[model samples]
Target: MDEDTPRLLADTNPLPETIDARLAQQLTFLIEIDRLKTVLRQSPLAAADRRENDAEHSWHLGLMVAILAEYADENVDIGHTIELVLIHDLVEIYAGDTPLYDAGKGLDQREREAAAAGTLFGLLPADQAARFRALWDEFEARQTPEARFAKAVDRLQPLLLNWMARGGTWRTPGVTADDIRARKAVIGDASAALWAAGQELIDEGERRGWSRPGSASIT
Candidate 1:
């Protein structure tokens, strides 16, 4: 099923005690995550009227894992990397989407998202919640190869979208090449080839006068 589609809730019809507990909890968690589709991101959809949502972003990142896994500096478990990207943005449902260039907007981002992760993942069964939360934390820590690759793709996706839209988000008044580089440093750390690809896009944006040099923050 598409990750964004809402599943039938177990509570919609009263369940007998015989219903499997794990299955019921999993279904509930799935239904809740469907809210991710409503959490619109700052990045606009390419050639579309609307913005991309957390669910679509996660799905795209999952596809990137399959397509770009070869570029990772160290061998990574594709399945684990997919899992990490799939849930990385679930917290955005509660914390809300923070634009890549809007550094001042999410001043308490870590604390807010950490609490959001706890609540969202906690909806799953005990073991599954713990495991999924661990994956989210791993992605945040960026220590393991899987986490690093996942983060690289996470950064790469927005850059691709902005380039496609001819500087969609990058056109924000104060956004600059330096802001892109600062936010996208992880791409180089995990995959030099992918980083080069991203830089090529940025260079083209600059050449076309779609992106300009400026500081993201004045203070």
Candidate 2:
């Protein structure tokens, strides 16, 4: 070896310990998702006056996936769909929830959600980041069968809560039947079965006097 080579080696420092890329990626998913437990300032639970936290919402949807998988159309991939459901609400950790009756608020909804998606999903390592973002994007785009079904499950949650809680959080806002139906129609593309289930809930709400036939429950 040349004397210059020895000098160059002396000048260099040892590289920092490298982490296993795969393990790093896996651990990212295990990382405690932060800023994800804030209760929506305006949104409420079905039967209660208090607003539910994003973590509660996400967990509720995850349970729906386990219990309602058979209701999904096209032999849905339950595991991936559950992952999608779990992360879908993560953006709310940053952007906050926009209620359906809050007209004109959606103007910046896409931009805010996209930014939140980047920040939250980027917490994971490269490949896992890509995977998480793809799941979120698919739900936003409402394009794939899995995404469609995930979206359906997403919509079903608030409705079930509002209906069962007998004027839960949704009752206070005076949300209307039309508003609920329109927001939930996106689910029809994924599963007519789930949509039918939603319709049944609406009918039951009206029949039980939880809500009016057409008007919001509060009014």
Candidate 3:
């Protein structure tokens, strides 16, 4: 073994055997998640000058959940919903951000993200890792009310940002309004009010000529 390797391991020290390892595990996981700050997404910030990273995306989703929970079609546990949003993209810290418009790569993407989830969440103790993994899975599955709402906001955030930026990513060739609408359809199922807000943004984008006239029909 390298001389510094043992020293680095010693610094971690695994806490004390008698100490509750939960705190240490949780802290380790928290520190690992900070890597997300460096994982940039394809979507640009509202300013449209630069892209937003996964950490900012998760933070925005958390705030959206707080502000929009009341509009969910079904009652949701707000805390659980927040947890779902915050950790949903932690896998991206390893898998990297796949653009929403990317097609023909879903299977590979899922496999990559699953492996990422395993390694990243494994930083926590077994029990906490399982819980975190389950939350991420639930967000992907979108079966629970909380998960559905979280997914809706996840889709909504970028759409809103794109709208505010006058077609941040939408302006890119091959990104159609229909593509956006189809991707955002879940928001309609989750919250009519939020869906209405999203549609209004889309309409404004159309009116301002931010989106190509025929782009909506491309898909």
Q: What value does the lDDT take at residue 127 in candidate 2? A: 78
The list of candidate 3 runs beyond 4 A from truth reads 1-22, 104-107, 215-219
Residues 53-115, model 1: lDDT tens digits: 899999999999999999999999999999999989998877788877776876888997888
lDDT of 3 by residue, 120-208 (tens): 78878898889999999999999999999999999999998887787888777777777777778889878999999998888779778
* Clash statistics: count for each candidate: 0, 3, 0
| TM values, all candidates | 0.90, 0.76, 0.86
Kindly report which residue pairs in candidate 1 clash with one another: none
CA-only RMSD, every prediction? 4.5, 10.2, 4.2
At residue 33, candidate 2 shows an lDDT of 57
Strongest candidate by TM-score:
1
- Predictions ranked by lDDT, top down? 1, 3, 2
Q: Estimate candidate 2's alpha-carbon lDDT, on a 0 to 1 scale.
A: 0.70
Candidate 1 has its poorest 10 consecutive residues by lDDT at: 1-10
Q: What is the lDDT of candidate 1?
A: 0.85
Q: 55-137 in candidate 2: lDDT tens per residue?
A: 88888888888888887777788888888899888877667787765666767888988887777666577777898899899
C-alpha local distance difference test of each model: 0.85, 0.70, 0.82
- Between which residue pairs do clashes occur in model 2? 45-169, 46-168, 47-168
